[model samples]
Target: MSATTPNGAPASQPKKTPQIPKGKTELKILMLHGYTQSGPLFSSKTKALSKLLTKALSPAPYNLHPTLIFPTAPHRLRPSDIPGYTPSDGAEGAEAEEDDESDNWAWFRKDEATGTYLGFEAGMRAVATAIADAGGVDGVCGFSQGGAVAALVASALEKPHREPAPSPSPETDTSWLPLLRAANNDAPLKFCVVYSGFYAPPPTLGWLYAPPIATPTLHFLGSLDTVVEESRSQGLVDRCVDPTVVVHPGGHYVPVAKDWVLVLAGWLRKRYDEPAGTAKKEEGNL
Candidate 1:
């Protein structure tokens, strides 16, 4: 059939090419907040970094549009649960409600006596739901506790990363991995970026590092971070099969400066340019 113009005359059609160039590709990334923070708060802190990443990836051959999805942790902390939180004398009711509704959130609670991570599974479940809702994400970036969760998410998506539990117990819930895998349609994450991350000390989660994580990871550490020690971040670095570490002078925060953002953008570009199947081969090597 001929195409008709406004005047009812046949219009010429352009010839089709043998191979059409692909349109702009979306690189969806999950952003996880730190302990005592919410999604919006995290997003606001990383606004500059996000913008730089978007600008770097949105051009020419890359043609990648970076979409960042920030998801708050599911666990809410009580006044007592938060470090250094103190209620005013006789403060109650509305004051309590107001405090509860504010910036107190955690991915998991540390069992002080045993160093176990409580509520870890539930936190991962929330992340899995977020991934499914987004249809999936190419990668994840997190700060503090959320950074630890991001690493765990990377570990969970790759099945071979699981080794026998350090001490297997029937009570341990290892089922979240399947949920995460299914949520991402079994496609392993291309990368993970963690700021002030630490290793989960719980034996139940030891399987996560039974074989160190294979997904390419970029870890940012603070020289004077009092909240999460530099050693803690190094402990996590030691557990990654491939890790690129960046040390900044700041403390316990993601660096939003253009210089640091460019480092991340450069690393991401390299990962994106790697030939297909390289990631799987790297995973198999472990």
Candidate 2:
């Protein structure tokens, strides 16, 4: 009836052990938030999607669970950098900058006249540190500016592994690439999820798209996204070898609706089916 330790003052019932299922799999994903959006804010925005991903992807035998990690961008944007900002909003924008502390964030800041990002190296370093600390991630997802960075990250991991070299000049420092490549236990990310992403047309980053992105990518585009136009998002799709595109009714935001999420889940399931250690088979679209 009862089992007790040494001293026989009283007897107690033995605790029943937990019956856990086997073959259950879990994956960690790195989420890059859009400009002006921090990690916590992005997490709140996609709470529904994260939950839906678990439910839809873990129906039974798959039993797939995902851990999403969001890392905030390091650069702080000026109030003038906010979208829809107008000169009439001068006083209000200043007040907003004084009131809000988290809105002005960016992965890279663009010089309007020159049309080039100024902080690419620093931003990439921050992302690389996050991935290295996580020991690696299964995939990456982003929206808007974050989506552009996600595409580059996946490309960086696709490069051949090499030991990081000495710090090079700002314009010439490709050293971070090797470090990011080495961070994933020397493996490339499994997939990428891009929402309203656009190609970054920079001379230094030309190598990223020289060979079409081989990683399996799922792109979400909004028909009415005025901020990052449909054409720009298509530009990124054109760089991927064979991308799965999902067009939704919304604009410039990740759709967390069940229907839209299921599309992502289906694509993810197909990716999971591929044998581990094997790169996704290239599909012709370029």
Candidate 3:
């Protein structure tokens, strides 16, 4: 029988509604802040980026949703330790031992001569504790020095294909391994996001890069960034087995504009939708 809408004429069929994919589980990402910045500070800075990601990836075309975790570094920094430090006019030029501001922190102190991080183990352990407490993560995202740590942390989670697993170096602290293992639950690191990141030039850190990490990496480089220098960020790209590069027209800060954020969403969508090592497929296009 034909149905009518209060008339003899037959009612037209209703148009079909579009179906949207809903992800079964949300992937977790541990976020690391840049030097002289705490997790909370960085989180505040990235609110725009996070909001854009949610809008772009949570419905319709892209179904991937990510939960981000931000944890503070364990090391407290002195005024001298921070970049762009300026001594006060008082005290006959004698410096204050501690900064009154509570937010001062660093993932590690740089040894300019040797190109080594003085407290990498302590800093990484602090990060690991945060992840372990959060019940693990699927990826890591970081900025500047934190971005460098993201790469190192990813490499550390990866077991070298052929190695005896030797002891930690004399200059480096290895206490982070236990917590790192706990944070990852013995699973491979799925992906890493680096903003204005660089390669760790120290000989002690060679192990982390020698094997060439296979985790899908999305690296953001600022064309005008004087702090991390383009060469340094490129050096990191050269070390990764597969990396997705996004160049922004700005400086040291993370670009949170719609265009940049959408680029990130697209990369992340591919990360979730495609298998590992397939990132190279889109290399030419990017």
Candidate 4:
């Protein structure tokens, strides 16, 4: 079946086939793309990695099959062009142009100063709905800005939403409290994979708190990444409650390194092989 927007725009819903390597247990992996790109863009770009992952997880010495779910970002465009929002050349340019013609989209607005995202709650909710519609997910993987958004989405899911209480006194300070309450009421997410991501909180918006996430996570950063410095990615990794970092020698793009596909495949294999009860127990604890 095809997926389409309310306006009949083409969407990225892939036909559900029996998970590859039938008879083996399957895990659902939701992959989100970086800025200026759609789900199908990443899905096509990461085909090699996905194939490698499927092979690596096969039973015997390794037996596993993961059904990857790629969800398109909700279409959006800046009302006015913002500086530093232009796409780079080559594949990036092609993807950006395609998205632009379709009405350029972004998961959230980027804060130029700290690189933190703003107005991400709406995108997060959309992603959550997509995942639920796709039959839930065993794990999530994202690249660059997608990575930052994924982390925030995972954090949001772990807390329960609470209505903000109004303060009678004008002198009273209740700014941060409301945000904290909202973030404290979300659902729990499983493992996450972040590539070339930054971890700055939103400016003056206490709603964008980065709680100590307990989900197992894998972080990949390019040593030569200028767009998102390795130091920044490392900082985010350090803040994660439990995370493993892998440093690749290259630039910002994931396909630049030859071994990245292998590395990512291995990570996915490990994530999808965890006992079913473990995920359930973790969800319960959250």
Q: For each candidate, C-alpha RMSD in Å?
A: 11.9, 11.5, 14.8, 7.6
In model 4, where do residues sit more than 4 Å from their true spots? Answer: 1-17, 78-100, 111-118, 159-187, 203-211, 256-258, 269-286
Question: What are the lDDT scores of the predictions, listed in order?
Answer: 0.80, 0.76, 0.77, 0.62
Model 2: CA > 4 A from native: 1-23, 87-100, 159-170, 274-286
The digit string of per-residue lDDT tens for model 3 on 6-58 reads 31212323423323346535667889999888777888999999889878778
* lDDT tens readout by residue for model 2, 56-92: 8776656787878777777766566777755563577
For residues 1-286, what per-residue lDDT tens digits would candidate 4 score against the true structure?
Answer: 4557763334645546664565677767778788766677788888877776776666655566777777776645542333365555465656545543553456677667766455565556557656766656667788887887766656545545322235444643334333422432333566788888777554432343445566677788888888886676876787677576777777786662336666666655555555753433332121
**Candidate number that wins on lDDT, 2 or 3:** 3
Model 1 is weakest, by summed lDDT over 10 consecutive residues, at: 9-18
Query: How well does candidate 4 match the true structure in TM-score terms?
Result: 0.70
Residues 1-286, model 1: lDDT tens digits: 5553342222223422223126778898999999988777898999999899988887877788888888777777767677787778776675667653555678789989888888888788778877887788899998999999999899888755464454556777766777888889888898999999998877777778868898889898988799997777888899998688888899889999988898788778777766865543443222
Error of 4 at 283 (Å): 23
> Clashing pairs in model 1?
none
Candidate 2 achieves a global lDDT of: 0.76
What ranges in model 3 sit over 4 Å off? Answer: 1-24, 60-62, 91-100, 159-171, 275-279
